[model samples]
Target chain A: MPRPQPEPVQVVKQRRDAALKAMVEGVPYVQWLGISFDRRGDELTAILSYDEKLIGNPLLPAIHGGVTAAFLEVTAIVELGWSMIWDEVEAKKLEPEDLTAGALRLPKTIDFTVDYLRSGLPRDAYARARVNRLGRRYASVHVEAWQDNRSRLFAQATGHFLMPQRDG
Target chain B: MEDRKATLARQFIEAIPHARALGMDLTELGEGLAEIVMPYADHLVGDPSTGVIHGGAVSTLMDTCCGAAVMSHPSIPAATATIDLRIDYMRAATPGQSLRARAECYHRTRSVAFVRAVAHDDDAERPVATATGAFTIETNGGAT
Candidate 1:
């Protein structure tokens, strides 16, 4: 298929904007998984709500590990914006709205690995992330999620996301 | 279902390194559903700042849970990969509490399966987080 007339950059910008907004409103997966979102500047934080549905037993209910990965992905996407993905002269910066319209998109994950620690219970789960270092070819970031002042960790991950080139 | 549960328990024991590292016990397992828990230890708590548990640590446990559940099925025969996963925070685990997770495979077709899981810290009555995810079950026959 011939490339669409709209600048390739526009494609990304539109998608980027949509992604940003969805990041704010949360996705169906979030609702299904019971994950929530909170944002500040370029930073994003995931908030897990405490409830009966989340518990597995007394003192040791299973913490949904997928939610851990999802939170990290969200933080990474938001952090990507501040990183080198935006540095390309030809790359068009996208707003939260652009992604909502559906310009940018994510690919099927090839593989992911995670290391888990203290499992936090229902009541307090929080994780923060930063882009850290990034390049035109790719970006890398680190994230940490914690629960309570006690800081029982539930999950962590290291992975990659696709970034197709866009026209300036 | 009984056969499936036995298969899940065997797989859980085989898939997760921590199940042994943390001395995990198989609480329960069934068709499209399973629950596992591990003895709590101070070392699992990796966060120095908050003196609580680290998020990545919890995620790892759940990842294995998902992988084990999907891989245990006889029909599907490939390693599973996650598209992405997100978790919300509610409260910290009790200092001496163990971690438990209930995982369920909702929809399954050739190569992809939709899953949901919930984690609790010592109190199954109240969950710390609920998780839903997509797993690409890399089948040998391109079943999907």
Candidate 2:
């Protein structure tokens, strides 16, 4: 059964690394998604890790397209939710206890699209994506990868994420 | 055979640019249909719990087979890109020799083509997954 909803949770507007780690640990399956990030200003440069299990074609030693797509999708979700996490922390400034519950909230993924430009080989790989447009109703993000001086786009995925809605 | 696609179907390995590296070959082809196979490896297996092969590999192979089958038409100029691809896993791929995939163009309009495919190791009746995809043919040649 789906969990019951609490009242609409507004953006707290704060930031912390502990919150990020906590969220990452929240979803055990997320480890399989292969995503890591470093923030530079507002943009994020993420290394999309690849494991042997992700391989489809042993002959080419190329990572599978579905894994690439799934990786891109998770990257977008975490990066977008970062802002909401920060917001929640900021709200806690009024009362430290409020921030404690902030880490529990997660972003709602509405929709996303991935465009595959080049294959991500078995060699070292990563992705760089930035939020293109973030509005109340929707958001869009663009991401790609580079290795051995060759710039092959793994994907250009834009998605719609909704904030937590209010409940009685 | 009397099938148009069968006559036109490219030999799985000998026909493509890099089929040898991927261990893929033509399984069968007929009017509005064709199949390709990629030999399995230890790397394809995922967590023992799900025992499922990664979804990404399936999409890539299926996409390649579908596009290749569609481009076989001489006028098509052998160029295609995926507009959208969706895969649904019905069963897990057991560690085996190879994975076989078959695709067909269900409906072809002027600019867009609709294709579907299934992947299985041996038992064709028991498919690992089903895939439906949209392809946009680049008539200007595959270079771009």
Candidate 3:
């Protein structure tokens, strides 16, 4: 069988962008959880629309811990994909077939830790991630989710993801 | 008394929206242990390239299992909430297998309970993920 050829640089970039857009707009799990994204300059925010399906404690009527954890993790991945982009010049030097050949690539979670500071009420929630560091093979992110006010945190998480390598 | 406790515990698990959405089933409940299962569904896939189940689904299973353990503990309280949880993913779960989670509440205090859990598909020895969590109890007159 003939070996598969690497896609052109422009094609790779387009593929990466489409993947990210699908993640934010129509991914199955993300859409089920009602997650949306807004990117402004360098800041990316994940929004979780309120629904009865998110409530864990019916009495307190609070959101589920697992749901909140997933929200934070997704926010981290989304931010990493959009914020850690390589310039066109750098992409030109990398391996044509490398996984991170273009500006962004998918990330796999190595570890996820979440702290539940307060009960998440049955209301819309927002989350944002800060990339602590983005290395060639790994990245670390800190994410926080809040409802009503940013000062009032519903949950916070720190995640480490394994990234695909690319040449300098 | 055990039957009543088990029934209450199942009720608590069924009340949660995410658990209900995932169709979690409570197979067993004891003083401080719980076993739950999540059936495979195509919509649960996280990666489009690979049809394997999402890590979040496993996390939800473990969390719900741990919560059931806390609810069924001997020193049951009126209400409980997760304080913190740390999950380590050993590997991606197989695409078409039903994942099961078993959790145990190791200890309990006046205001907190400690729980540990593992999620596995077919092989009991190899876990897809494991987690440890702390839950805060409502305590005292608050015991429901």
Number of the top TM-score candidate: 3
Model 3 bad stretches (over 4 Å): A1-19, A86-105, A166-168, B1-10, B140-144
- Best model per DockQ: 3
> Would you list the C-alpha lDDT of every candidate in the order shown?
0.54, 0.58, 0.80
CA lDDT for candidate 3: 0.80
Error of 3 at B23 (Å): 0.7
lDDT by residue (tens digit), candidate 2, A65-148: 556655665566667666655555444442343224223444454444456566567765666656777676566665566644
What TM-score does the A-chain of candidate 3 achieve? 0.76
| Regions of candidate 2 where Cα sits further than 4 Å from its true position | A1-15, A40-42, A90-103, A148-152, A166-168, B1-104, B107-113, B116-132, B135-144
- How much is the lDDT of residue B4 in candidate 2? 47
Question: Candidate 3, after superposition: displacement of residue B76 in Å?
Answer: 1.8
DockQ winner between candidates 1 and 2 = 2
* Model 1: residues with Cα > 4 Å off, grouped in runs: A1-168, B1-8, B47-51, B72-77
Tens digit per residue, CA lDDT, model 3, B1-39: 868856865686677877989988888888899999999
Q: What are the candidates' individual DockQ scores? A: 0.06, 0.13, 0.47
Q: Give the Å shift of residue A88 in candidate 2.
A: 3.4
Worst 10 residues of 2 chain B by lDDT: B43-52
Using TM-score as the yardstick, the better of models 2 and 3 is 3
